[model samples]
Target: MALIGRISLDVVARPQEPTAKKRCLDEPQPDTLKRAKFSDEDYDANKRLRKFQESWKVTYPWVTHEAYDDDQKPGLMFCATCRAYPDLADKSSALYVGCSNMRVDPLKKHEFSSAHIKATNKKTKDTMTMKERSELATNSPIVKATKRCMQITMNILVVMFNTVYSLAKKCKPLSDFETHMELHVKNKKDIGGDYMDIGTNYHNEKRAKEFLMSIGEQLRVTKTRLIEKVRFLTVLADGSTDSSMTEQYTVLVRYVSEGYPVTTLASIEDIENANAFGVKNGIENGLNKIGITDSSKIVSVNFDGAAVMMGCKSGVSALMKEKNPRIVLIHCVAHKLELGVLDAVRSIDYLLKFEDIVKSIYKFYARSTKRRRDLQAFADILESELLHYGDVKTVRWVASKARALRAIQQNLFATLGHLEHAASANKTEESGKAKKLLHEMKSARFVKYLHLMMDYLEIITATSKKFQQNKLLIMEVPDIIKSTTDELTLMIEEPGHQTSTFYDHYDPETGDFTDHGDHVMKLSGQRLTTYEEDNDKTTLLKQTVKYLEVRFMDFNEKPLKCFDAFNLNKWPTNDTELVKHGRDDIKELTQHYIDILTDTEHSSMLREWTIMKNLLRKKKTGINCHDLYCELLQTQPADIQNILTLVNIMVSISPSTAECERQFSAMKLIKSCRR
Candidate 1:
């Protein structure tokens, strides 16, 4: 006989031969010895087993639980204690069965069975002790809540840290952070819960300073990681006098990190001496502080062409060159370009006089309180906002000139009105000065010169800005210089540009160019007519073109030929000098990077060069070295590694020390007069 527990009627039984012997009641069940198959009846019975414990656990506390709905069958509920032993299933009463109706009180009857007591004693003897269970329950909730609280605190700290670092980078005062925290605290109270204490912990300057230091450490660690991978580096430094009368040198490091050129500020330190040795020692100290010790790893050094910095025997570039003969020395391209522009304009007499006239106009108003007030009165009368007249600064070559011209252009009518009124009044010493300015402003030559120079300055200013970009590449600058010079040439040679759109104050409603005729006609009783150009305009254009040719000739020199070799628009032909420079001169500098390629890659390099010549001829403009390298890498992968490596190495030589100039700007904000 077999116990048929939760057996479905639909189950098919295997045929068995009839036996003569009668089975005894004490025989073990065949199904229980082997695993049972799943049936619909078992699934129905499993549901009943779960509901039984929920309603009857309190009525029979000694009856322990078991899981049902297992893989072999729908499953069964059994007494926990009785199921612990193996032989009880063969008894007249087995204590385990599938749960059905809770109303039958099956668990109550099973609790009193004799087999239950033995199994319960065996299982409890080996289970967890009462003290151990109690300790686990007590500590689990506390550990979870502590972790949640710490996570919230760390999140708040991170937010405060980012806030302080952002404000510090912009040179904002730390008191602003306190005010921000106060606002947050008030908002938190209004929201009705004390969920976090972020405002309380970081609402002061001391904490803000600590956060700023932590951010600095994070940047240092990141730079260190990048430096560890660099095969070579270039160190750039320049000296400037800050507002505090202290000599400061800003140090920058240029290196290849992950196949791209990156220039990052290493440090800014104050020095007593402002010579080559002072800057050299200061840079060495900064490099040491940043953990860069190997001088041999420095492949190049760049600085402005100042005598103190670019001197052949004693300059920083020359001194570094002495230590490592393989190292390249480059004067800052932006500084050289600015000097070229200055040299170009200085050769012409009228252009020099034009610059003086612009400076005089700025000073006439800025140096006199009465003239400034009179100019403001005229501006107000015309319903225009106050104008900022800028002074000429020696260091800010392009921007200062451009700004002064733009100011005069934007407020031409009001300026002319103020000068004419002052000339008519003639009540003070400034009136006499204003009378002279009135005559100059009304001159036909001055008007034409203003238009000509303003247009020229606009081009120079735009190119100068590109030069000052923080990560300018050396190969990219020659194109900008060529384009500027070409544009300047076009302005000189191209016809009818004089009658083209000139910078003038425009009427918002009418969309026509407005002039000082109405204001001057009323004050001087004479109507101002349009100015006609004289021969000075032709002379000005000629001198500008001549100066550009003389100054930009250096970029075409043999030593700098490598910088121009890859230009798509100006590809060198098979001239002996060009081929020699492209092969021998460039190879001398790029040999270190070329050594990194495998034999197969070196073969690929020659193939890529031949392909580039054809491709570049088709696409003359806007194809940079990086673009050419990418095309080569796609078409021929096996040959591109050496060229790619060389391009990355060459680009790491920064074209300007503008980053050093920026540090001085920051120093002014940090050590302002109030500080």
Candidate 2:
């Protein structure tokens, strides 16, 4: 019975299967195979699997589920922005394709990932209009943060630069840069950011030196540009040994800038050899460094009266003149004055003796603190203020000697009292020297010579001060020399006030002393006879006058004398006198500067010279050459351009090397022994 039932069931199932199998084979086989592979139990189990949640979209806006047609299937998660811009997406990231492992961790990780953020930003940028993109970029938090960082960095750099500049300008050592930066950081805590805390390596001595060099290079470039624009310039040079015993030559350029003569230091070179050729090379190198390559642009050169600098044939000035014959070579007038005075002093025996005594007195007090205290004590006792003794410098002889003489004169009674006390106190070597100095001080001849020199130097010292003036013009030099010579000549006829006062102290006839004033000592030596005194005075005064004339004889000659025409103070007031007044001078000046002027310019200068005289005569105002030239420069008339240029050259010519001397003084301060 079971076999018969099985066969009957197989027969019934086979007929139903045939129709179903036929249908499956006729239709697509993929869906039928899928249905055959999974039963209802398996489908229910797979539908229970975890899927991308819609709630994740709240936390991660870039998250989205994979598209599905049926609700029974599990969905994959993905970053929609990353999928749209696949290049900006991470290739290994599961979210970049479709994340089947639909956990919140992967979605959260992808949302904050660099790739996802970049894709999101790119999508936002692509969708915006131009104006909208600009606004978004401007208002973005990241951009604002970046700008703030840049601003802080710039502020830090500015502070560092300013600190370096301040130290350099004050001539402080570069090693002090660390200390200065620390001070800034302490005062302004936010100045250097992390740089300040990490040590001074960022702003150390090496960095300071680099900053200083950069600053110097920039300033040099700027000055070179300014010099290249000017038509003419004057050069002043001087050489000296620094603390390291290195010979340094300082070169300065003088040019007319905005109607004022500006003397600027161009360069300070370390010269191995300080001879004529070496010094000339140094000067040319300095000028070249400042963009002054054309030797013809140099209108004048002023140097001290050293043979190597001012020699006629083989000197620096001569060499420069050989290159450009139009250049005017000037011996520093201040140096000339000093030399002239020294020559006169060397001719007189008593004056030389007087100089030795003065120097000895200075050294005696300067060397001993005890002697200085005693001198000060005696000075206080006499109720007179005394100046400290100054060394008699051989370079600036007259001025330094005058200061020393003034000190002695003010402390005359105090010095005598100190000497008398020391002489009586003991038999020490110092006391013996004091006794000898006291004997010399008490002599009538010594007192007379002291006051005589004091009076004579007072005049020369005043003249020396004028000669050292930086703005002293060549046209005014002759007048200064003439006035100084006349004042000295007047001193010869009428004795100086101090000398005449000394004569009042003692009896003229007898060789005996009278009741001396409290300021001076009673003298016991023989007084000078009137003839001897006159002869001595005549010798010093006449020799000084003669030497001054000889030393400054060039100022009275050709081109320099012709510059007098530019002296408005000496201009003739009358029209008849003015018409022909500067005609010869103009011709000579034009001929002198023929190389510097064109033929048209020469003719224009001649015509303008007369016109200028006439125009200035109409105004009749007492204006100086500099002031007149500056006013004319404001208008810059076409006809007077050549004359104006001539005046510019003249004013730019320095009368002395005082500017170079000042630079040396500054160099000494900067490169001191301790440094």
Candidate 3:
């Protein structure tokens, strides 16, 4: 359907000349095509300028062939200053001018001009004042727009990286955001949305890695500043294997920053082995690379109680101490506690049997798909959810043992039903294993010991968690160890704690007092023995308490005992009693450094110790010792400088190397099997 009729009005021009004769297919190229695609106006402009030889540099050394514009048919020469700052051009100055003349030696003439001399002496735009640059930048639309675009692109990259890091997500956001913007540009141009295509590099894996490295460099710079500001810090080191099975040691620096504990991950180094020599070298090289020039600044070294790390003579800590006598070595308190728990558990026979039974029940379901399915079916029939069994983490974190026990306890009824059903079925390998698991799960001894170990390890795991806290103070650690030991002692001696934990009935509705009567009744063949014969629970608790006391007794030895004096509890409130304190622990603590300190400084420290006691009594509110020292620093009291110096010594003492252990946890996430 035609909407309107077309109008036909045409006029023809008179033909004055005919087209040129057609050339043959194999004819030589036309003269017009043989010449470069220069327009007549450009040709005329170039013809007007005097051409100069390329050797003009001989007479004018500053003139270079790089100034030539190769895009022009005959090319043109430009002064370097004029090219760099094209707006500097003027009618009188040959220096601020460009020329295409074949006959005139403009370069030679321009070199001697006063304008050229002035332009050469002027600073480049990079050195220009901010105000001048801002004015110039804002006036030029192209430059301003380009800069705005570049700034926006950088902002986008920063936000993208921040989101990825903050959320602990992968690099997908980097590419995903770019892809979304690309799609929007394609489909929403009419709506005024803008996304200039920077293409694959902006969103690719290579660019993502480059940006990550750039962030690492920035963090390193910040870490360096913090380290230098603190001047002296303890080195907390630990080694762990990645998913790829490569042993990497992470070095962390612990120092007091603004009244709080500040721990920075200084470096992550891959070592040849986990031996003392290899780890020690890795640490030295890593710290050196990170700008820690003086080993003497390492006032203390802390690591786990591994033989290679804490060996008295040949360990990494010993090696460091040998190099610098001032560096005191301390083992990780949390790790030592975990080791004690492991030792206590392993020493008992019935407790080991309990652990084996729990592990066996987990494997019974975990190892067989059919068994897990059957358990799930039983859980569904009973209107409950099945719990997954946890693997025991042998890395001194006893929390996993609790999780495993809890899972079994939660699903005890359904799991037993599933096993009972399997046991009653026709004979099969699965049935046989199910019958055995059912027998153990129903044993009165197994039920009692499971509850026993679960409760005992809960205390150990809690202490572990407390030690791993980022803000825990070194002075606070001795108290924490004592309290933990006291809690274990209470757990051993107090019958109420025992009866409530191990023997009490767990109520599912109230989420307390779970009873094991029904699980014990389903025992295939085993029965409960007399109470006198079954003293496993009492024995396990006693062993745990004994081991803890032996392990934690390290706090009482030598220079470490001096740290206990620094605790505010020991600081005498009366000035008359300051010099007559309980023991001369400070002398022993600082005895090794007497040669390093001047007589005046030593006297100042003795005087400050007296004043520090008064300061503590004056500010009577409860505050952490490390925090109190930092607060005192703000007043800049001359009398407290020496006392503050002593506080720094205490602050430098690492309570534990748990942060390094946490880094390994992050390593597992970062370097996953798929990753």
Candidate 4:
């Protein structure tokens, strides 16, 4: 008190402190009235938002469990109407809003209304304040139950999402979620980053496994979209790195006989060797887990052609011998097919050069995050729609698809234009080389023949599947096989089919365009004006039709009762027909593949293996010796043992990489769905 008096005296002496403002003690004015207003524009916007929400609600049911954006946060059982309208306004007007429970629940709100029955707020016996009311119902059981129901729906959605991507579509958003949600359930489980899924928590391992099993069980309950009944299971194992850099192996098994591609079994395996062993066992277990097993029911095992899985005599291939001794070890044909194309590209001088340029471009574009973005920008600037959206039809020149080669032949000049422009900003030795390569690519003799391959691929891929499924509609495999082989042989043998040079050959005998020699001998040279466009189209059309017919015909000969049925064809007369057809097809495919691979840097050595498999098929009496090599080679061959491995891949394994490839497609959708 003394200190205060001293300060006050000091202030008075200083004269700096103005006379203390006299307090205005008069009472304040009364509060102003509040009014509500509405506009057509606001009404329209609200209607639109409502429509969007409702649409989302139908598409994404999990949203039902989710707290509405405008709803109250956890702790209340809000009526839908009241949840939508959280505040009451215009008491004298008909437009009313507020928690419906507050109006209808006599215990909570004595004046509750559903059909707008008017009610007045009645004082409780204690005349409780707002704080007192909340305190008495803080852990409200009704609110908790509402939240629990929401949690159940969310759990259902999560389980569905893990099994299939097309489950959860979209849900609408609300303006006020908090006012409606009296008891909210937060993310109760850790979601995985890989696939938008309820993630695995080691602390909850047993629960997670059970949940995963339940997901599988749920899929079974989902009307069993599986088209094919269980048959010879064709297993394929391939390893890949996830976003987290963990090396995960995916094992897929196809149940043959189904014409359409369907995943009969799928599983993700571990990385450790024990894990590798575990993965293999897990695959076997999962097959049983998905209803598979018994030795003879399993027909083929296809892998990445890795020695770890394919080595002769001692690997998993042999382990299968104890189960199904005749189970063939097939290599993924797409891998070999691609390898063949790479090999073929490597054989040609300009094509090889062009491929190298493409490699350089791919590397530059794919080197890092910044580079990829720059590549996209460059693509946009160049407006080269053919910068390979990552497909077979437009993979530069070498890695291009069979049908695209023809288009690429004509488009080579245009592609060069893109490469030239792309090179302008790239001031390196690569740029200069690329410019020269641009010219070679356009002039390359084999350009026109690339499309011819489309017919071949169409024939092979379709026919291969039909043959595997025993659903080939064709009669007499030999007749069709012979004709088909002869057709391709004859096509390749055509004089104009393989031109050697870009310009007309100047015949020394006549010094004119008239002395145009056979072009087949000149395939190593270039293109000519005589090359007819209709000729290519006609031949492709013929081949494609014939191929399709044969494939369908093949379906009739031996309905594919098993997956990976390479040699699964019935013997025309003897018990050896399956082996014969398999041997012949492998040789032919390997040749065509090798023909494509003549120049590829990464040689798949399918040709060598094709020969080896044929030799095995021929030696009918040497089961003991052949069986020795089978076990030895199928287990794990040394680095030098690739030749033996390649044969087993082509002769015995999955005809195509469709199982894993389909998985890849599914993975893409899964990622987007999760995101």
C-alpha displacement of 374 in model 4, angstroms? 15
Q: List the residue pairs that clash in candidate 2.
A: none
List residue ranges in candidate 2 displaced over 4 A.
Answer: 1-171, 174-179, 189-204, 391-396, 505-520, 529-533, 618-624, 634-639
Runs with alpha carbons beyond 4 Å of true place in candidate 4: 1-214, 220-234, 255-263, 274-279, 291-300, 326-328, 332-351, 357-400, 403-407, 416-434, 442-484, 495-655, 668-675
* Residue 124 error, candidate 2, Å: 12
TM-score per candidate: 0.68, 0.76, 0.72, 0.41
What's the lDDT for residue 654 in model 3?
A: 80
lDDT of 3 by residue, 250-338 (tens): 98888777655578788889998678999999998788766797886777888988899989999998998888988777888878878
lDDT of 4 by residue, 602-633 (tens): 25444444444454455534443324444545
Off by over 4 Å in 1: 1-146, 193-195, 366-387, 391-396, 424-427, 470-472, 494-554, 571-638
Worst 10 residues of 1 by lDDT: 521-530
Better of 2 and 4 by lDDT: 2
Query: What is candidate 2's local distance difference test score?
Result: 0.81
Per-residue alpha-carbon lDDT of candidate 2 for residues 1-675, written as tens digits (9 for 90 to 100): 999999999888874424443465567566545754678988877675676678888888877788567765567777788889988889789987687786788877777889888998899889999999889887899998998888877777677778888876777777888988777667556665554333344668888778778888999999999988998889999999899999999999998888778899999988757789899999888888999988888889999999999999999999999999988999999899999999998888987877777777887788788988999999898888878875445313677777777778768788889999999876699888898889887777777788888898899999888878777778988888889899888887788877777777656565444324455346757657652356888889889999999999998888888888888878888879988887787788889888888888888887888887777765547565556766776677776777876778778888988888888888887788866
Output the better candidate (1/3) by TM-score. Answer: 3
Give me the candidate number with maximum TM-score: 2
